[model samples]
Structure formats: structure tokens, C-alpha cells
Target: MLKNPFLDVEFVPDLMWFIGQFDVYDREETKGAELAVYNPDDECDREKLIVKYGLDLKCLSYRHKFVLVRFLGEKLDDPNFDFQSLFEIGEDCAGSWPRGEWYNLQNPKGFLQDVYVNAKKVWKKDLEKAALEDPSTW
Candidate 1:
């Protein structure tokens, strides 16, 4: 019953993230599409973990609803997600949603890597407005 068509995957330890729903305009413009980085194991704070991943405050912005997730607890050597860039595009409470496609990048015999490496414009919604809103939804 989710609006987004992306699947959740944890390739590396402490790096659980979704490939779809990517709305970052540029690598530095990831503020609007960033999901929260949580420490379910109590090893580090959210901010600290984000920093370790080279994600800065400007790189992430919260949206309306939060996605529930936990970081993997292990180490992955150069586990190239094979996706230098990824994003999502859609809206909640909208009926005319686009056809959803669920894909697992890690799957063999898939073109996930080839597409992303040569992608020019990815479709993704900008959810920064939802994150910076006041506690009271005015």
C-alpha cells in the first residue's frame, strides 16, 4: 500500500537504503531526497553515521512521512552499489500514479548498473517541503 515503487535493500552492513524515490538534483543536491540514517544498534547517533557516509546536513532533507529502516551491522569492502546515483518520483494521496516497477540491483542478469551509469534525468519527487514544516501542520 505504499505510494513509492522502490524496494528496500541492504547491500552492506549499516547501509540499508532504497534505490528508488531518488530526487536528488545533483550529488550535492541530495537534501530533498535523503532518508534518515538511524542507529538501531546504538553504536552511533544519526548525525554521526550520516557524516561517516559523506552525507552532510545539506545533503538530506526530511519529507512528510518517515521510512522505517535499520542499518546493517557489518562491513562491506568496496561494495559498489553499482549505483553512483539513484532517485524516486511520485506523490502521496494521488491516484494517477505512474506504473510502478520494482527492481533489485543486486539481482544477476539485470541492467540496473548500465542504466544508472548512463542515466541523464531521473524522475523523483522533491520532498523537502515536508521535512522543514513546523510541528503544527498549518
Candidate 2:
């Protein structure tokens, strides 16, 4: 039996929802091959397909784990994911992940986007406050 790594962590409800979505992606017989063949010009259409049929669950989980580790300060055994560079894109930019080549697709409902956007907003506010208090830290 495959071991569950997240058994002990206190996952927020949205993160758990993402995990459930990834579970569906994992259990599907085709293992997300259905998403692999789709090539849509509009990103919204691609996200609609993903919401309808799902994409690579393992890949999605890896991304979630990365956000948990890198942004949320949760540590787990490294899954050897090599896509950390892509996650560094700024707030206004669209990013790509390798799985299914789902280019320019960002689900507004996704936990990663929520965490990232909120984190950036908080950081900007904190930085502005900090700069006023201590210009040397800038």
C-alpha cells in the first residue's frame, strides 16, 4: 500500500480540497492522459477542461506540496520536484508547470493561487510598514 505523507499535517480546508481533487486525478484510469492531449488557445477553456476532467494529480500535488513547504513553512520529505523556478513568477505573471503542458492556466479557485496572491499582498503591506519604520532594512 502507498503511504500517505500528509497524514499528520494540519491542512487548511482549501488545501484538503485540492488534495481531494488531486486524488481524483490519481485514481482515474487514464492517469490524466485525457488532459495531455488537449491544446486550447484560451487559458480559461483549459481550466474549464481541468475542472471538468482533471489533470495530472501527482503533478498538482507536487505543486501544492511545494507551496506548503516554500510559502507556508511546512516541511516534508522532498519529492524531488524540479519546478521550483516556475513558482517564483511575480503576482501579475502567468506561470507554467510541466505536467500536461497546461500552459498559462491558472484556476482562480486553486489553493496555490490563493496562497500566493494572499502571501504577496501581505508581504507588500508588511514591507511598506517596515520600510517606514526602518529604512535600513530596505
Candidate 3:
């Protein structure tokens, strides 16, 4: 049995929208074109990515935030895991945001870590709670 009452309730657009922002999504759509031009070493490129993702940092609901920061965090660390095989991006994306999490960032790892560092500074308690607590309990 699960602890969360909303276990069956899907965190859709929030979750998928989060994943769709990074180069990971573009890598799938553009045949690795995003991976080719994305230069993480470039300061301008890095800053651009930071601002892009940072703007939408608070858009995620609490549960959705954890789902992104934690699981996506894991995916960032894994070179072998291919989440694209299991999921696909398409035309009908949700949310009120104009862009709807479609940045095609240069570096997913840097984007995540940078966002985590900045987010941890302001949302320390919330981020930490999500980090420490097991998702199974949520």
C-alpha cells in the first residue's frame, strides 16, 4: 500500500513538460543535433541555459518538482539509460506558459546542477525535504 492519497493521480504536463525542456528531448527529435551544437564549456551558452530553466523553476507543483529534481537528477547521472525509448515528445504539449518547457538547453547536467544550486538557496527546506524523503512515502 502507498502513503500518498493521490498516488493514481498523474502528474502529467508538469512531469513531461519538465523533461521536454532539456537537450535530452532535442537529442531525440533532431537526431542528436542539440548534442552537436551544445557546448557546455562556453560561458554564454551555460548562462543562457541557466536563465532558461531558472525561469520555469517555480512553475512545477511541489510533487512535480521533486519528481523532476530527483528522477531527472538520476537520469542526468546515467549515461546508459535511454528514457527516450520509453517516451516520446509530440505536438500537443500542455501548460499556460508560452514556450511550455521547450528550450533545448545545451547541457542537461549543467542545467540541472545549476538549477539545483540556485533552487537550493531559496527553496532549501522544500528541496531538502523532497531530497531526504523517499518518493514511496509521498
The C-alpha RMSD of each candidate to the native structure, in angstroms, is 16.6, 13.6, 8.5
Which digits, one per residue and each the tens of the lDDT, describe model 1 over residues 24-63? Answer: 2343234422323332122243223333332322323232
What TM-score, to 2 decimals, does candidate 1 have? 0.16
lDDT of each: 0.27, 0.37, 0.48
Superposition TM-score, candidate 3 onto the true structure: 0.43
Query: lDDT score of model 2?
Result: 0.37
True-vs-predicted CA distance for residue 57, candidate 3, Å:
4.0
Can you give the TM-score per candidate against the true fold?
Answer: 0.16, 0.26, 0.43
In lDDT terms, how accurate is model 1?
0.27
**Highest-scoring model, TM-score:** 3
Tens digits of per-residue lDDT, candidate 3, 50-125, equal 4554425565556555565666566657888554332334457432211222333344455556655554555566
Clashes per model (N, Cα, C within 3 A)? 7, 0, 0
- By TM-score, the better pick of 2 and 3 is 3
Show model 1 residue runs off by greater than 4 Å.
Answer: 5-15, 18-47, 52-65, 69-138
